[model samples]
Structures are given as C-alpha cells and as structure tokens.
Target: MKSSILASAAILAASLEPVAALSEPLQNILINTDRSPIYRYPTDVTRGIIPIPVHSHNDYWRDVPFYTALSAGCISIEADVFLFNDTLYVGHEESALTKERTLQSLYIEPLMSVLKKTNPKSPFVSGPTRHGVFDASSGQTLYLWIDVKNNGEKAWPHIIKALQPLRDANYLTKVQNNETFVPGPVTVIGTGGTPLSQVVSAADRDYFYDGPLKDLTGFTSLVSPIASTSLMEVVGDIKSDSENPLNPTQLEAIRKQIKAAKDKSIGVRYWETPGWPIRLRNELWRMLWKEGVALLNADDVNAAKEYF
Candidate 1:
C-alpha cells in the first residue's frame, strides 16, 4: 500500500512539473536598466501603427507630431519618391519637389543612422559605426510605402534601377510593374497596371499583393483563379463630404467590402477617411472592427492610437 501511494504521488508531481515550468509571475522584474519600449508589442499581432511619411511641405524637422508618432512605435511609414534633376526627393506632388530636401537628406539619412545604431548590418547603413552608440536591435520594420506619383510607364524602370542598391542590400521593397518581389527580409508591394491574374501568379511565388475585392472578382471571372497562396491585403478608400462624416451609402459600401474581404480570410485596411475627429474615428473604428478590418491607416498616429 505504501509503495503504491508513493508511486501515485511521483506521477502527480511529474504531471504538474510542465505547468509549473510554463507559468510566469505577472509582476515587475527588471532585466536591464536602460530598456526601451520599442518592442513592447508583438509583431505578429495586427495592431500595427503606420505614420504617413513627412514631406517637404511640412517642416519635417519641426514636425513634432510625426517624430513623436514614430518614436511612440509606428510600425510603417510612407514616403513619396520623385526624381528631381539627379536626386530623389520625398514630396506628395510634383509641384512640391525641391532640391534642398532630398529623400536621402530628409528620410534615408536619418533612418540609416537610426538603423546603424540599432541593426548595424541593416541594409540602410552606409559607413562605420560611431563609438559609444547604443547597440539596439531593430524592432518591427517600417513599411516604406513608396507612392509613385509619376506615370506608371515612365517611372517603373527608373525607380527599379535607383532602388537596386537598396534592393541588393535587402533594404528596399519594390511594388511596381505587377511583380511583388520579396527578396530578403524586405517585402515589396507592387502597384502598377498589372493584371490581377499576373499579380496572383507572382504572389504564388512568395509575393504579397494588395487589391480591392471588386477588382479581384473581376479578375477571377476572366480565368479559373488559382488558390490564392499569397497574403491578400484589402483597402477601403472611403470618401467623405461635409454633409455627413461619410455618406450613408458610402459607409454601407465600406461595410460590404469589409465583409467580403473578411469572408475570404484576407487582411484589410481603410484609407482616405476623414481626419482625427473623435466622432468620425470612433464611428469608422466601430464599423471596421465589426467587419474584422485588420489595420487602420490614420493621418494622425496619435488619434489612431487612441482609437485602437
């Protein structure tokens, strides 16, 4: 009897060992004194914050909101690329292009510096490291959404060639000419006049595609669509007028679109919504969240962060 009792106790103890090992106390325990909260959020999770890239119009240096948004953990940022004379500048429109604030000066240089201090081998870094710089690890990547404001035909090759160095070094992602190239750790989202069938085919070869459901349906109707092996990112570019924050019909349309995309188990994003007004943000967030929209694009990161 004593032997049997001891044997049962040992088995019970063994069973509990795994659970005990897995359990961690939910209390504060400092690992390092000078830790940054950059990686506080998990990358796999969908609460990614994306800031609109600063342009020459905004005093990029004095843009406190933009920097604050980035420092506070915006996972993605956009920059409009235009070749002026021989240099690439970040500006929303061609009219705003200038020589002083080139893309490298405004964004690339600063980004490269930050990356060097964080991830020295980051394809963005150029020269030797500065002494006594913080050896920080690169946290979640920033999606350098290069919005090509130029004609698709004229800009494709030039942009591709210019990005070669970054592409080769595995820092740039190209989203043009209907080919989604995911070379290295960088993900390029192509956005040219490529047929959906061609985009879908390339996606099968391990590329990401962004499209609207309406457009995709039209593509499928033409051909026996292959099982979409690549990830699908949906966008709802909702329009707003002064009469209503967003027209009732427009809101309903967005809802239907979101539903259709979610039904197919694809990630969704909405753009061109109103600015960071509380009522508008809340309404959009509630509606989009209900339809299972995965990401929210905001003009102001702070407003979006509050809603999320």
Candidate 2:
C-alpha cells in the first residue's frame, strides 16, 4: 500500500513537470514529503545552493550526478571520462558505464541549464560581466576537472566538441593574447594523462592544463591555472598518533611545492589526503588550507565543509 502511494505521488510530481529536471532522489523526496512547502520549480531550490571551495571527487557516482555536489556547495567537480565507440561515458570504472550517462547529459546539459538561469539576458548590465556558478556569489568560477582515463590525445577533440554549448555561450575562461586570463562561469582543466604539449601548443584554447605541483617553475597562470600532486608522495607518510605530524624535512618539501605553484600565479591542490584516524585527517586538511591551497580536494565534501 505504501509503495503504491509513493508511486502515485512520484507520477504526480512527474506530471507537474518541475522547471528543472529532477534527479532520482529529488523526485523520490518530493514523492514522500508534503508538497505544500516545496518550491514550485526545481530551479528555485538551486537559488539556495551556495558554492564552496571544496572539490567533489568522483562526483558521477553520487545519487544525482551534478546536483549532489552542487547541493553540497562544491564549486569544483571531477568527471572520469572513458571513450567507448566515439562516445564519452562518465563513470569511475568500466563496469559502471551506462548508455544514458554520457558526459554531455550528466555535466554539460545541467551546467548549461544552471548557467542560463544564473546569467539571464538583461538590459541592466553593461557590455559584459563574468558570472560564476553560485547565485550567492557570482564572481567565483567553478572548476570542471576532466580526468581522461584513456588516450588523451585521441580524446581531446571529443571533449572540445562536447564543450560547444559552453563555448557558444562564452561561459569558459579564456587566456587573452597568451597572457591575461579571464575567469568565467566554468573553467575546464584537463588532468591525469592529459598531454602537456597539446594543451600548451593550442594557441587559442579555452581549456587549461593541470601542471605538476612538484614542477611548477616552468608554467604560469595563462597555461596552467591549477597544479596538483599526491599528498602521500610529497610528505612520505602520515602518522595518526603523533601530534607534531610533519617534521622539518616534510614541512620544507610541502612549503616548496606550494611556493612553486604560488610563485607562478597558479593554484595548487593535493590528492589522496589521509582519510582515517579522524583527528590527524582534520589536522592535515587544516595544514593544507592554512598553507593556501586553492581547492581542498575531498571525496567527502560534507566533512570538508565542516573542516572549513
């Protein structure tokens, strides 16, 4: 009887047709909850979703793909892309791939929708102003980190082609005359096996390369807006029991890596941060944030929000 009631409620919500496409969980929530207090339109709910500095790692695996991260106020999100039969499938593993969850459908469409609502055609504004992802603060650009799981050179063209809607709408951050960078609603950074030569050689490209955090003396902000390295690799090992975790050597290495990235006018991020031994994990997170890391890459964004 309860299942029938929820089913009937879901059908009713679907029939009404909310302004934005409802994710599976959201539809279920609407089905179960009282409709009186719910927002009339789905887009109305996004107005309250503020953008945060945290990055959502493995974002596609979540219940609602993009909406899950956005609802958590994550300004940065990652998508692991695999090329299969000339189509980009968004998934963590090969077995998880699906026909319906293409990069275009899961990321591009939803992004375009949100951006359209955020940056509406208005007469009040002047020539042009860059709009960010959040309704609360529209100046901060959302970083779309694309981790190419296969041949990046072969996959580059497809990714560029997929960004057509954003490109057409002038939503991508662009480098002016190979010198000045203008941050827009979305800044796509290609990482993990993405070729540096291809990224650097593109004289007129919207996408930027993720520079190596350990080797950042060569590149500047124009080509690489962000630099990243493995936390474990950098610091050697992290101990949960110790209060004074990082020794002199480890501290120096971290400072140098961070300084190198900062000196180039670029942002820095570290992956695979310690997760267990809760106290030490929090301490490590604090150390990174305090040292001026641009985006704190976190698999668990809720914990990150609280860490901040």
Candidate 3:
C-alpha cells in the first residue's frame, strides 16, 4: 500500500508539471507600456464573468495599497521627467514633488533592477526587459517620452546630455538629419500648446504634437510633407462632457484623424479620457480599436487590460 501511494503521488506531480510551466508568474507586467500599474476586478460586467484578476495601477509605490490585478504584458512605458536644478524627477506635473521620489529612485532604480535580473546585458542596467520592443543587440530602446515641462531651449540640451550614455550605446532611435537638435533615444512629446515645428526643423527629430482632433489637418499637411522620412505622433486631448457620456463625436473625430495619420503612416494617441471606471474605458477602447489605433495610453494598466 505504501509503494502504491508513492507511485500515485509521483504520477500526480508529473501530470501537473505542464500546467505549472505554462502559467506565467506575474512580475511587473504592463499591457501596452511598463510605466503604469495593473489592478484587479472581482467581476467583469462586459465579459459576463469574473476575470482572472485584471491588472491595474496601484499607488502602492506611494504608500498606497498593493492591488492584485495581474499584468497584461505592456510593450512600452512612459515616464515624465522634470529637471529641477540638476536632478531629474518623475512626475506628471511640477507640483507633485517629494525628496524620496527622484526619477532614479521612483522609476529608474526599480526598473533597472528588474531588467538586470531578466536580461543581464541590457543597456539600461537599471531596468531590464521593461521595454521589450527593441532589439537587444541594438541595446534597450525606451520611448522616454520626455515632456519638456520646463524651458525647452535650456532644458532640452541638459536632457540630451543626461541620456548621452544610452545614445552612445546605440540604444536611442534617431532621425537621419537632425541628429544635433533632437537627441537620441528620447522622443520629445510636447504638451500645453508647444510649437513643434521649430523643434522638429531644428533637431530634425520627430515629435508628438498635442492639439484638437480637427486642428491636426493643417499640422499633418504642413509637417509631414517636408519631413517625408520623419515621424509624427498626433495626440488628441478629448474629454467627456455631460451631453456625451463617451464623447461619440470626439471618437468619430479621432477615428478620422487616425485614418488620415495612417495614410501618412504617422502614429496617434487620445489623451485626457477617463482612465478608470470600467464602462467608460471599455467604450473608449472599443471605439479606438475599431478605428485601428495601435497604441492606447492609459493611466491605469488593469483597466486597459480588461478589453484585451
């Protein structure tokens, strides 16, 4: 009887091995990008069933509760860097400052540790496999959407200098001609009425211009024609109003804009949409997906993961 029991136990363990191997242990995964956190929901109303613990953002990095939402494999991550004095800190705006929350401490340090463990030879030793989109031999390429929150002329040089190490390693994506102006690896995405024409012309680097959906017609026609080889990311800042719960008109406008941009082979993203609140997010996603938008930026990763 003891011999029989031992054999049975061994057989059970062997049977379960494949299941265990197939299950990917969640370790800081993001659906589209690695910058945001993943959250979990008890039930998914849209799917008519409970999901396997959807991943979403948790402010746990800020002494908030650790949410159980699993990661949905984020391809890229965005970190907004503000250079104060000589230090670069990660925050969306200038007001949210804290001594312990420097860019290295908050975003770079932890991310580097993760990358080192996963892919030891990564150029970004501070964060490994975080941005898995680029070739390893080419070095890890991070979009590094550096929003020039400060003085563009002064701050731009400093930002480039700071990230010079990565550029030397060929980890940066650069435009053919404008190497001097728009430095490598870091794509300058402007916000709050930033004039990108001079920047694009001077640096010969591609950029993301934030404007209304309709306003994109002129910009795309003007910029894209001359810079045929250049890339442009048009970001539409749309919001929901009382009259429109999901902003159907804005969605339609975005669709048209994306179609036009695609014809030119440019990228697009819609910002300022409600990130959480499952119903609203799903609706927005459904619209964007239908329009064939490749990238979806979300403040919360888990909310975005549900649709996928």
By TM-score, who's the top model here? 2
Give the deviation of candidate 2 from the true structure as CA RMSD.
11.3
Against the reference, the lDDT scores of all candidates come to 0.45, 0.84, 0.45
Q: lDDT tens digits, residues 130-164, model 1?
A: 32111222323354444555553454445445555
| Maximum-lDDT candidate | 2
List the candidates' TM-scores in order.
Answer: 0.53, 0.83, 0.55
Candidate 1 vs candidate 3: the TM-score winner is: 3
lDDT of 2 by residue, 95-172 (tens): 999999999999999999888777766688875555766877788788998999988888888998999999999999
Per-residue CA lDDT of model 3 for 1-308, tens digit only, reads 99999999999999878654333435334443345434532112112212221222222233321112213333334445567787766566778766666655654444333333333344535653222222222232333344556666565555555555444443344455543333333333444324464445644444444433434455542233211110113333434433334355655555666777677655555554566455656666676667765456555655566567
What is the alpha-carbon RMSD of candidate 3 to the true structure? Answer: 12.7
Model 2, position 9, has a per-residue lDDT of 100
Q: Which clashing pairs does model 1 show?
A: 175-189, 175-190, 176-190
TM accuracy, model 2 = 0.83
lDDT against true structure, model 3:
0.45
Evaluate model 1: give its TM-score: 0.53
